[model samples]
Target: MDFYLAAVLQGLCFSGLALGIYLSMKIFNIPDITTDGSYTLGGTVTGIMLAAHIPQGFILPAVLLSGGVAGGITGFIHTKLRINALLAGILVMTALYSVNLTLMGRSNLPLLAFANLFGNWALTGSQGPDSLIVLLVITAALVFLLGYVLRTDFGIAMRATGNSESMVRALGVNTDRMKITGLAMANALTATSGYLVVQLQGFADINMGIGIVITGLGSVVIGETIIRRFRVVQPVSVLAILLAGAVLFQLALAVTLTLGIDPTLLKLVTALFVLLIVSLPRIFQSRTA
Candidate 1:
């Protein structure tokens, strides 16, 4: 039971990454691979800062900024250099590997002895309750903020840009700016998730981000699959779905652990889950048609 609760809490921390993935893939129609790097960038910055005794408030914003910068660079490459979006994202993600290593001054940074965001709660024997409270607060704030943003005029322009860049450009909307803004925002959220995860896990590893992009996409797909009927409520529905997916992902991990499954096989499970979710709609549509 304790393991189950822990996994759920951890999943909530990762919900931010799932949201970021949804924004890039669903909203912008961009297959952004930058998230794999940005997630580690966030964790690297946050872990380093915490180890250096920086205040928690400062660390959080810095982690977000690091992600935003990495994403913006990728966007710039795609828009200004005429690079294919996938290649541009790959270039940025590759560069971030070195950048993250530089930030950590090593392949991994451990926060086992450092002060974390939930230190007070942990010291008071309230870690579980406090973590749950914090997760809910952050999740609610993100959902509301994203909902508001997606309803704004600029948001409409962004959605239009995604649907048809040429049409949006003809309408005087700067499609390049929209792409950059979307990517930056998406990666900022991704990094924030990384920051939260390291705080909860007590360590940031250089390899921690491996397969994160797929995992994020998996979460998005799983969420969308379950809530496909809500066309008007897509954003909110996707958010709920992502949160639920994260919980389910964690629950699966817990089950694997209980079954004595090899921990390393977890990534394979995630990939299989993603494959299943991705195929479900097509399979169903074909059968029904």
Candidate 2:
């Protein structure tokens, strides 16, 4: 039971990351690799603050704003300087590594003694349920706010721009600004995940974000597959589907580890899993053809 509960908690910790990837990859049709940097940036900031006995109240917003700035720089480079979007993300991600290292002053920081959202007495439950409840609140509130935002006029324009940039530009929407704003919002959410994760795991590492975007992408692909298979047509249902996908993804990982797979091979396994997810749709199309 504890093992399964831990898997669920892991999913909830990464829920924000899955949503961020959904925004950038599915909604914007861009593989915004800024996720790798922004995630660690959040963890680094939160870890540093808690170590200094700083107020926890400002940690999340600081992390979110830092992530937004990182993403905004990437967007500026891509839109204003005509750099390829992928390259722009890579550049920012590389630069953020240095920034994160500088802030952390080391490769990792332990938060086991830190006062955190899930560690307080206000939760009124055991550690497992308490963690799950807090994460659920954050996830649910984010999904609600995201649904509201996506239903607004500007959000519609953002989606339209993603669907057809030329059409949206002709319709007088500033596609560049939309892209920039979307990237900022996406990274902010990604950073929020990082903040949650460092708190849950009791440690923050510089390498925590390494290859992490793949996990987010896999969760997203899994979510999309479920939504399509079930014919879930509501825009809001996507959020629920994503939450479920993250849980299932973590469960799958737990199963692999339980099966005695070498821990060192986990990254390779993830890569293959992501490859399978990416190609399954194409394979299905070919079979139907």
Candidate 3:
């Protein structure tokens, strides 16, 4: 039970990552691989700030700004230079690795000695349940904020840019600016996940973000499956479903671990699981056809 509970907590921590991916892939129609770099950049920023005894308030903004800048660079490359979106993300992600290393001054930064975001809370006297409450609130707030954004006129324009770029461009909208801003916002959220996770895990490792985008993609895929199956249309409800999907994905991994699968095979399991989810609908469609 505790193990599964921890999984739920981890899922919540990754909610921001999942949301970022949703915005980039589903909303902006970009496969922004910059997630792999920006996530670690977030953790790196958090670790540095926390280790220096910096206030949490300042740390959060710094993390968001760093991630946003990284994403914006990718967006600019894609839009202005006419580079492929995927390749632009790759270039920025590659550059962020060296940046993160230089900023951290080391490959790993231990943060267990400091008072973390969750370490100070004693609501339940058990960090796991207490942390769960904090994460739930944070996740809910994020969902609400994003839901509201998606409903605004600006958000409609952003969505239009994704759904019908040519039409929106014809309507005198700056589609390039929209893409840049959208990617920036998405990566800022992704960085927030890094901030949350670094504190939760008590350390920040340079390689922590490696393949992290896949986890986000898997969560999005699961949520998308649920959305399609139920035909969910409400923006707020859709965001909530994605959050739940993140939790479910973590639970699935927990079950796998409990079954005694070698820890070394975890990534492989994740890949296979995501593949299965992605392929299922097509399989059913084929059979019906």
Candidate 4:
């Protein structure tokens, strides 16, 4: 039970990443690989700040800024330099690796001695329940705020920029700025995931972001599958579905681990699971046909 609980907490932590991926891939139709880097950038910033005895509340803006900058760089490269979005993202992600290392001054930094976001919550004399509640609140607030944003005029423009860039451009929407802003916001959320995870795990490592994009992608894929299955068309409900998908994805992995799968094979299992989610509908349709 505790193992599964931990998995649930992890899913909550990654919810931000799932939201980020949803924005970039689903909203903007850009496969921004910057997720792999900006995530660790969040952790790196948090680790350094906490280590310096900074207030946890004061660290969030820094994390968001770092992540946003990383993403913005990718967007700039893609839009201004006329590079492929994927390649531009890859370039920024690769650069962020060194940036994270340089900022941390090492490959790994232990955060066990620092104050975390949950330090103020002393309920039940155990961190689990408190952390759970806090995460739930945080996740809910994020979804609500994001939903509201998506309904605003600027948000509609952002969506339009993604859905029909040429059309939005013709309408004088400055599609280029929209793309940059969208990527920046997406990576800011991704970085926040890193911020939460590093504090939860009590450590930050340069390699922590490696393959992290797959986790977010898997969650989005699962959410997308559910949305399609239920024919859920409401925008806010779609966000809720994606958040639920993050938790469900983690639970699936926990069950796999409980079944005695080798821990080292977790990544492979994740990949296969995502592939299955992505291919299942096509397979069913073919069979029915």
- Best by the TM-score measure: 3
Candidates in order have lDDT scores of: 0.85, 0.90, 0.95, 0.94
Q: Rank the candidates by lDDT, best first.
A: 3, 4, 2, 1
For model 4, how does the per-residue alpha-carbon lDDT over 1-289 read when each residue is reduced to its tens digit? 8899999999999989999999999999999999999999999999999999999778999998999999899999999999999999999999999999999999999989878997779877888999998899999988988888999999999999988888999998999999999999999999999999999999999999999999999999999999988999777888889989999999999999999999999999999999898898899999999
Note the residue pairs that clash in candidate 4. none
Ranked by TM-score, the better of candidates 2 and 3 is 3
How many pairs in model 2 have backbone atoms within 3 A of each other, for residues 3 or more apart or on separate chains, i.e. clashes? 0
Q: After superposition, how far is residue 224 of candidate 2 from its true place, in Å?
A: 0.3
Instruction: List clashing residue pairs in candidate 1.
Output: none
Task: Name the regions of candidate 3 deviating beyond 4 angstroms.
Answer: none
Off by over 4 Å in 2: 122-124
lDDT of 4 at 6: 97
Please write out the lDDT profile of model 1 over residues 99-124, one tens digit for every residue.
88988889988899998977756533
Report each candidate's C-alpha RMSD, comma-separated, in the order given: 1.8, 1.2, 0.7, 1.0
Best by lDDT: 3
User: Which 10-residue window in model 1 sums to the lowest lDDT?
Assistant: 229-238
Q: Compared with the true structure, what per-residue lDDT tens digits does model 3 show for residues 1-289?
A: 8989989999999999999999999999999999999999999999999999998889999999999999999999999999999999999999999999999999999999998899878999898889999999999999999999999999999999999999999999999999999999999999999999999999999999998998999999999999998999999999999999999999999999999999999999999989898898999999999
TM-score of 3: 0.99
Tens-digit lDDT track of model 2 for 1-289: 7998999999988888998999988989888899999999989988998888888788888988998998888888889999999999999999999999999999989999878878874576588888888888889998888888888998899889889999999989999999999999999999999999998988889999999999999899899999989988666788879978988888888898898999899999888888998798999999999
- Cα error, residue 98 of model 3, in Å, equals 0.3
Task: Give the per-residue Cα lDDT of candidate 4 at 52.
Answer: 97
The worst-scoring run of ten residues by lDDT in candidate 3 lies at 119-128
- Assess every candidate by TM-score: 0.94, 0.97, 0.99, 0.98
